[model samples]
Target: MEEKYRVLADTAVLAGEIMLKAGAETFRVEDTIRRILRTSGFEHCEAFVVTTGIMITLESSKAGTISLNRRVSSKSTNLGVIDQVNTISRQFCQGELDLSETFQQLKNLTPVRYPEWLTYLCMVLTAAFFTLILGGGPAECFVSAFNGLYFMISRILNRRLHLNDFVFNMFASFFMAFTCIAIQTLILPELLAEPAIAGSIMALLPGLAMTNGIRDTLEGDYMSGAARIIEAFVIAASLALGIGVGMECCRLLLQALV
Candidate 1:
């Protein structure tokens, strides 16, 4: 009975950790964990979730108490993984999957990602189309495609540097703006710099984070919602700061050249 309790604890914690890391909302994570624990016939199952961690406690007359805590340090926006976790938990709760089988499935679950080439291609297309949507000409669309390299460069540098999200995004946007301004000044003077910069930086915007923050807030997850909103704001500020610095530097250099 003790061993079974331990296994259930492990499974519930693992599911909560994965969902939290994959950007699931606070209430959702807590609810999932609670449901998973309830299946074990625990008299009391409590799940506490925040943006940064998860804590679950299960109490039964036979097993006494089993408690688990999982800290989540890194997170990314992956709605698919969140959905997968939800599905698995639902299955476990519905008796479609045994506890051990559910645990195995969660353990093996991985986020679905597009190939690098395809991802990059989509990035470029996204920038180009955004440029058009914002009333930019063909030249702007062309330049925005190159500016879309921001994602590629950031990914490469982040793999080696492991900087936090704000710093990483600031540096990437700095590089992007600098290059875009230089191209406009030195080679593509006829192209509008604003659209290209605007379009490319769209990729860096924390839209999903902001949206989730609002949703969480509406759902009464105030702490988690506030944290996510603050995160989105920080990223936006970093992007603005990087672009401002890059543009000022480019303008001064051009003045010197003239």
Candidate 2:
């Protein structure tokens, strides 16, 4: 019985960790952990979740107590994984799955990712449309598409190199800004750099992060909310810094040429 309780606590904490790292709301994460533990017969279960950490404890007169702490250093958006975990938890609670089966399911779960070509195509379309919406002409839109393509490639390479979010965003933004300026200066002198840069850089913005931060704050997860907000700010600042540096360097190059 004690061994079973230990497994339950560990599995519940693991589920919460995965959800938290997948960018789920803090309240939702806590609720999920609590529900899992309660369903597993741990009536005195406690789960505390933040954007970067998870803590869970289960206490029972018969089983003593079990506790765990997991620090999450990286996060990404994976709704599919979140949904799968939620389903597993629901099934377990309904007695459709035993503890061993639940553990196996969670252990074997995999995140779904879009195809590379599809992702690239979507990025191109996003940049092109954003450029048009920002009052750029068809020529500028075309240029922005190429910039977006390169930006996507840079992001993929950064991820492959295992760079952090801030570094990856900075690198991608620098590449985007430099390419936009170079294209405007050399290939399409008529191309407006402002709209092209703005449109392409939109792809690198921390929109989801900012939104989640606000949501967490409103839900009373103040610490997690503040951390996410600060993260978003840092990421945005890095992107701006990269863009500024790239533009300044391009300006200097143009001046030297003239």
Candidate 3:
């Protein structure tokens, strides 16, 4: 009985970890964990979830007590994984899957991401089209495509360097803005920096973070919601600061050259 309870606790924690890591809201994580635990016929089951961790406790006279803590250090947006986990949880709760089967399925679930080449092409096109949508001329569209290329290169370097998020965003936006200014000065004087810079950074915006923050807040997970919101704001501020610095340095450099 004790071993069975331990396995149940482990299963619940594993599911919660995967969902949380895949960027599910805190409230949703807690709900999913709670449902999985409740299916075990425990007298008392409690699940606590935050942005970074999960804790679950199960208690019954026969099992005495069982608990688990899972620390999730990293997270990314993978809605596909989230949906799969949710479906697994639902199946387990509905008796379509036993605990062991459900656990194994969740363990083996992998995220399906786009191919690297497609992702890069989309990034380049996204910037170019955004420039056109923002009323930029053909030159701005052309320069923004190169800016997008630089942005993708920056992402690849950051993966190897493992830089902090704020520092990475700052450096990326700085490089993009500075390059845009250089292109305008040397290659196409009529290229508009504003639209090009704006479009180039659109791919880096924290739109998903902001949306998840709002949803979490609406779901009554205030702490996680507030934390996510603050994170989004910090990223935005870093981008703005980098752009301002880059453009200012370009202005001074051009003045000196004249």
In model 1, pairs of residues that clash are none
lDDT of each: 0.88, 0.85, 0.88
Sliding window of 10 residues with minimal summed lDDT for model 2: 147-156
Residues 184-245, model 1: lDDT tens digits: 88898887888888988887899988988998899998999999999899999999998988
- In model 1, the runs with Cα more than 4 Å from the true position are none
Model 3 deviation from the true structure expressed as Cα RMSD, one decimal place: 1.5
User: What local lDDT score does residue 167 receive in model 1, on the 0 to 100 scale?
Assistant: 87
- Superposed by TM-score, candidate 2 places the C-alpha of residue 120 at a distance from the truth, in angstroms, of 1.6
Model 2 stretches astray by more than 4 angstroms: none
Model 2 C-alpha lDDT per residue in residues 42-120, reported as the tens digit of each score: 5588989888788888887776788899898788888888999999998998899999999888888888789988988
Instruction: Indicate the residue-level lDDT of 9 in model 3.
Output: 86
What is candidate 1's CA lDDT for residue 62? 73
